[model samples]
Target: MLTLIQLILLLFWTSVGSAGAEKLYHRRDRSDVRIVHANQARVITDKHAAEVFLSRYGFIKPVNWEEAQFEGSASAFTDDFLEDFGDAVLEGSSQHPLRNPAWDGKDPDGASQSFISALEEFQRVSGLPVTGVFDGATKEAMNKPRCGVPDKEVDRNAAVDPESSSSASDTVNETDANRTATNSSVSADSFEDDAYHLNDTDGFDLKGHISNNTSVNGSHDGDMGNTSASTHQSQAGHRRKHHLATLISKNRQRRDVSERGYVAFSKRLLKWRLIGEGYSSQLTVEEQRYIFRLAFRMWSEVSPLEFVEDMRSPLEDVDIRLGFGTGRHLGCNQRFDGTGQEFAHAWFLGDIHFDDDEHFTAPNTGSGISLLKVAVHEIGHVLGLPHIYRSGSIMQPSYLPQESSFEMGWMDRKAIQHLYGGCNGRFSTVFDWIRKEKTPYGEVVVRFNTYFMRDGWYWLYENRNNRTRYGDPVTLQIGWHGLPKDGVDAYVHVWSRKRDTVYFFKGTRFWRYDSENDRVFTLDPEGRRYPRPISEGFPGVIGPIDTAFYDRRDSHIYFFKNALVYAFNVGANALARGFPKSIREVFPAVRRGDHPDGHIDAAYFSYTHGAVFLLKGSRFWRVAGSRERRRRLPLPRNGLLPHEEVGEQWFDICNVHPTALKLKR
Candidate 1:
């Protein structure tokens, strides 16, 4: 038998070993819990990100308050109440006008403040509480419809609603009632609907007249099917008629007889090839290919049109052929002056030719013509849009070197939508795309440099080799000063030879970020235009930009809003003119033209393989050259496709952990 001291020591060592093992087991269990929590949280985070993304880019204007009543619904109140509401909130009445306003009419920020004060004064005069909030009774009073501009006469023949009623202050008047009659007999006979068409000779015109009876004044349909809030309607009483006249005048313009308006290819799917002569020296072969691809993608996004590159041979029967030619180009009767006269031209179902004699710039050199701009315009002709006289139109008769690249004017979008129908689904922002990428364990954010944006919070991913750690989550606000009341739509980190800035897009505005100091800066510091309108900062551009990224290869930053992509030159603080191109044009194989359903959630360049990766839903693609070569990613191990519903895996995993331990034992 062993001695008593030896037995005691042996028993003590055994007990100590058992206790240590238990402690280690508990620690491992806690680690697994944390991992599981992160996975579970990903979906919630992504959902918020998606919502913010959608809100920023969608056509819906940000309302001041959800509870605010608008003018259209306040017919129970007197017309005087409506007219007075407009005068008080918009132009201001004599009795209750704004006082001591700081704004000089140029600064939007100052103007907003001045407008609020005017509202307060109006409320005080109207015997309501003097709150500047744009909701409830205040919103109802402010949104009342009124007459057009005093100086300019809106053509009565083109009027949408030829109402001549004076507002009733105390009681209705018989004369006013007759003048503001709602009968269909009151019509604008001189307003020919076909006159609004691009080319009457082609027997092509918009199918139906734009609706004139909507109660909401200054409300316009966005290109992406979102409701763009009317900024100009803030002043109009007879807003509908005024707005309609403007549209009609803008649509009716001079065009060459040969270039008929609203033409479209019969086939939804078509193949295009490059001639053996290749592209102009202005842009590299790759750049030209991308630009052309971009042009086609934009049209496809809004219509049932798809373009595929004919990689086989130029001799093959292709729907469209592209090449460079001078003077008497392509053996066709059409000729080019080669300098500034005519940059490029394309006939329906015919080849698109670029002027070889003129100097060209791929993006912009400020020394030569822009190839991308000319390509978009020529492609419009190929797709069946005649030259329009709209100031910002892509199909304008002459090439505008100063216009933003891929600038699809409102009229252009409406015209194309009229021809091919509209986009299959509502436009999705870049964030919406990322959220759709359902990872097996949920989407884990990747951090590069000092930024760590995820959903509504930001954190630092700390690691010393394999031991990974995360800092406390900080709520991301508009200016990065404190806790954010709401989530952001999209975030981008730009690092290139031109700029070192991060951008955060939210609502109708975006903020420039200073990563080094963890602060946000406005576009104009003196003006305090931190949350400026997208149009103000970027001419011919609207927001919210769904997602944005810096392309190291091209040294350009791209902003994706809805179905279009805008290229921004950070160094120049200028949007690369002739931009806001369609994604389908750049990447053709992703979807058919008849069904442009999906959107790119995230995009990144793979320097390792010299290709670009675009993620859509659960699948990701690797695209190279002008053509899109697609390879699908493997499905989840649990056999769940991204769109398919499946049972929860975390719960199943948790239940199995204990059993797994017992099995190991």
Candidate 2:
């Protein structure tokens, strides 16, 4: 129905709902790009465009107010906003651009937690605090609103249809708040038509709905690449879309500034795309700063993040940190050329650094390759970008300045979209009615929440295995490990903001179940559980057993040896037990851990930055991403490698004689 979605006209005047709520649809004529008379086809309404555009930016659109009410909570900023944000949160969760809440749309409290988590996630990704509160920075990041300006007037234009039909206003039901708009005065002149569409003579009549002086049937226009539509809910109460919509009492105030059009224009930009400096290329201290700032602005976009916390209305919120520093390690920042092994690094809580010595040449010495392309790469690590297998890209551990970070290939774009989130700035509008509620902080309805491990939960590696685990990420650690009780087994635990806790499979002691008979066997020489049983009693199974992961989120149980993963639904019953059983779920050959194939890894539970890991040559690498907190540290010399590949892959964490890992947060 949205085939010609690009031809949208924002904030146009139109009538409300018609009888053809279903069964009919809108179609478009490509030749009808010219402007038409007031009686011509209705132009793409702003309401519809706003709905479609917002969803493109990783949001959702609600079918109606009632549906929005069902999905959100008192914590929701707005029903309309929540519905749309819900879609983005659910769909883009795997990449974790936003916080990941449980997928199931139940538990109002849990839903609130998810919202809190999403806000924190946005903060973390954008280099803000992990604190679950919507602080000033958080507000700035969430301030994107769907608005626009045109140079001319708007008129109905064209149509094409799918099997059924619907209208923009068909679903645009007025909530108690919006009901005021019906009797309210809108600056119709505020709708600019000339900027995007011209007042040309190419006019044509709409499907003759003019005689009825009726509004266009938006339901009829559904076809083509309508990604925004995909994220919209079919019905107000449908689970597919969870928008935040609300009806406000006429007490709503209006803006006073008449020259605020430019501000409004800027706000609309973020809805189109998330423009930013592409990946970074290596450069010196001053150079890095300049480039980073550019990249920072590029990523800012026009719209601020938006939410309707009960504390506030569905207003735009902008939250993101903008600054730059060389991630130069004290060793690396020796203020000299090529003396250290590392360049720069960024921590999750917002810390950045660069090498002081690595400067542009003399003469009119200008932009030089950065000393710490490694640092930018490291920051990428914190922001959720994984290392590239190739030896280039800023994300690649070994790539140097010669290989530009700015020139991203198609693969790079795809990878970013896959990791961070869809780059397109599609906008969705929802009325999140953030009302005064009970408990701590009455007005701010916290929809999401988060928590990182406390400092000292882990200690730096004192030996070999510990050495092979650093680079980007706040920290990395093997929190859990053990031999299979039924047989011989080995598990490697890992943690990080980049990936979080994971258990890699190593080896079984020496016992398992007989595949054919489902019988237990003592395979170990001792013939005990070591010679382990082939199968289990009712609760246990044998052979290449997986592990039992613990967490309120989507905890998992997996077998490293067999490369299998099992997901558990974990009902109320398992909530008490430290570990939930695999009631149901399966994954095979799904290798997971702090990383799938990182040269180094850190902390079982890192705070913000500085993960420690041993590399190929037995060298340790301190990887970190900077945020509002965190200070930059130099990379230790030759800390990236271990004597050999497995010289000590899984650090002897728990088995060590003394301490394990700690955070510098």
Candidate 3:
């Protein structure tokens, strides 16, 4: 029995509660602002703002006051505009400022001409209309989220000069421009954060080390926007800068390579670490380190370099130190703009700083900026790679949203290899591991995995992913129990209607393997002990074989030793007639002098590609298969195809440093 006023109050409160709950739900479902910052929401509201933006990002240079007045364009270049321009550009290129005088008002019309040319260059790189005017499309692109690294590292006189340069519009078509514009609009308007989110407040000065105990939960005390807190932080930053200058003077003899092409590390083995104090609040410590390990491993897969995480080493000894920071967080010379626009920047052969203000997510979370992608791109910069302006390249200056399935592109691989050559090493053996499994419905399926062995270590290559397992180059003793401590010479798998057996060979001895048990068989059904001599197993085959593989079609084990091949018939348990032939006669090269003629490393019969490959050193040659036999220009029987580098086909089968062999899980 409620009164009318009481009933009305109850309904009103209920509606308010319901609305609040609904707002929370929508906020949780909303995607993060990956590329655009809220602070830059209306930064380019007018033409004057646009000019300031251009000048800040290395697009337009500051005009000389005397020359500008001589050209009668002094009104356009106000003192405040010039001052802001100088401050922004100086901040952007603190390490390497653009010193070319050609764009700094040398010609009377240089100021106006340079402005138009810079606009055209910006539009061209951004995939927008090549109109030199400051249009709406160009303004939108400038406001979008991008890497903090300056786009034009060197002079663009040849590229932007109207008289000398080719038409910028010739590269991008109308369809591409329209699609880019639409995608950009969708990214900016629909996906940005609606509310301010507090970032990790861990106080770290620019000194490349972290002060962990200074904060709780790795966060600072006051709000980042607090005026008093920022003032105190600014003063603290000044002290760190003075300390950094002292360190630079102590190491004054160190030669710095300014050119990107010559900027690679002189050594192959490099050390990297994420500063303890600079861990991101968005991800756990393990998640951040794992992401970094994978990123470094990706580069190692394509090149001869190897990366190891060294936690015990001194800060100065570490080759590359990475950390997350807000404005003036790390003792870095360059400051991060709060959220949006510039996400991260890297110093050549030095440290990397990420803007923690941005929402960074783990790999494949499908919401925020991908920390892994950003890491790989930054590592490229540290390794001396300049920003590549091509589609699908990870080194693009602007931040592109991650695809569902992304990988290191071809251009990226080749570019890195050009600086540091490919991964080159000899292998003891290489083979495909085959097994049979049944589905829940009792359907039998045959599966196989590829492995490469060197010394006592082996790599499990994921054919589907076109790379080795994340922490591969595992020791053989751990993977293949009861095998030789050093490594096996070859692996042979026999599959026939009457029998299925697996064998491992080392020196003069051979061991029978029980595939079902994942280990070598001590005693087989026939009462034969393991480690029987090769002479006893195959009567005609010699000891110390180079490599071997079983051919399913012929039901024979082809044993390779020196320059001859012994085709041993499994059913008859004897060498095939007219076998033990010269290697050249058995596997002829399709092209002259293009084969692993003799003393090969391994012979693999691949079920994936349905062919046989002869591996030697770092190269591999594919034997003629059924498809080759049916070709219009059919290859000769057992003809070896042109040899190609094994790394080119099987991506990223790299070795980890001995110290980093056992990961901390």
Q: Please provide TM-scores, in order, for all candidate models, with all chains considered together.
A: 0.29, 0.18, 0.61
Candidate 2: RMSD over Cα atoms?
A: 29.6
Best-fitting candidate, scored by TM-score: 3
Show where candidate 2 strays beyond 4 Å: 1-289, 297-338, 360-368, 371-379, 404-406, 425-665
lDDT of 1 by residue, 154-205 (tens): 1122212212111211111112212331211111111235545432112211
- Writing each residue's lDDT as its tens digit, candidate 2 over 397-448 gives 3344433334333333334333223312111100111122356656544221
Instruction: Report the lDDT tens digits of candidate 3 across residue range 167-267.
Output: 22121111221221110100000101232101101111211111111111123344446566456644543343333334433222122322233335768
Task: Compare candidates 1 and 2 on lDDT and give the better one.
Answer: 1
Better of 1 and 3 by lDDT: 3
Colliding pairs, model 3: 35-145, 201-220, 205-330, 205-331, 206-330, 206-331, 206-332, 207-331
What is the total number of backbone clashes in candidate 1? 21
Tell me the alpha-carbon RMSD of every candidate: 37.1, 29.6, 17.2
Q: Which ten-residue region of model 2 has the weakest summed lDDT?
A: 425-434
Model 2 shows how many backbone clashes? 197
RMSD of 3: 17.2
lDDT of each: 0.43, 0.27, 0.67
